[model samples]
Target: MDYLIKTGCRKIVHFAAAQHLLIGKNRQNGYLHALYKNGIPVDDNLIFKCDNYNEAAHLTEKLIRSGNTPDAIFAVNDMTALGALSTIKSIGLKVPEDISIIGFTNGLISTMSDPPLSTIEQHGYEMGQIAVRLLLNRLSKDDDGYTPEIRVLKTDLVLRGTTKTLKEDKLGRGLLY
Candidate 1:
């Protein structure tokens, strides 16, 4: 959001699976919270309730045809981001140069894009390793009064070719200013 505001993206399209899922709900809340904190009013049109790649592509194309193309787009996952990329290009627009596109889950496909993709790395492999280790430990302990514990993994933002950063001097230019 700081990046979006800094880059002067007035309209941002958000793609989510469903508000019922905790991850989806959290992502929506975070996006909206960022806009609110930046003093930008939430626009319902910018929010897409589908997370599928085909739906994202179709919806993005529709927005472009309707002359309501967004300055930026954030997809729930890399596959969906790739879908948006294809539609954006079909409409004769350049990534980052025209509209910045970002995605969650820094999967293998992310680095395969023409300009690559900027995404959030959730460290799924590491997470799986940890899960397996926990399970083995529990089995070795014979489930002897072991209490379940919640572990939170940190997420990192990996910047790549799909996004842009503006040069700022001193106070800089953005909605917050």
Candidate 2:
């Protein structure tokens, strides 16, 4: 989202996941934080509780038809972003030209699209490896009670055919508590 703003995207539509979900909540927090830090006011209407493929298209279409066509669409995942991409193309609007898009979870299908989606790649394998190490280290400590561990996983923002050139691959991180 910060990248979108830096790339000249003013009106960004956020297709969010469920409020109760930690990942969704954290991502939304980051979105709001970026807007606040950048001095951009939040538009409640532009934020939708959507995360799936069909919902992405439906919300995107509804938004476009309402004349509140966004400058960019920040989808919760790659599939949802793809849905918005498909709808935007079908509606005769150009990606990034009309509305840029970015999504999380750099899945395989993300690269299969015509304009390979610009997505945040959560290094899941590294996360798993770190998690196992953390567990083992904790077990060796012989703690009497359970304690929580916090780890921040890094993400790679791969710029492909999505946003006009937000920059080369940039590094970011996600909080896992």
lDDT: which candidate is best?
2
Model 2: per-residue lDDT, tens digit, 19-78? 899888988988888889989999998898989999999888888998989999888899
Superposed Cα deviation of residue 161, candidate 1 (Å): 1.6
Candidate whose TM-score is highest: 2
Residue pairs with backbone overlap in model 2: none
- Across 1-177, the per-residue lDDT of candidate 1 in tens digits comes to 657766788788999879988789888887899899888899998998868789989999999899998999988888888899999998899998888998999998899998899898999999999999889877777566777765668988788887886666677643322
Cα lDDT for residue 169, candidate 2: 43
Candidate 1 lDDT at 124 equals 97
- Relative to the true structure, candidate 1 reaches a TM of 0.85
In model 1, the runs with Cα more than 4 Å from the true position are: 133-150, 168-177
Evaluate residue 115 in candidate 1 and report its C-alpha lDDT on the 0 to 100 scale: 85
Q: What is the TM-score of each candidate against the true structure?
A: 0.85, 0.86
* Residue pairs in collision within model 1: none
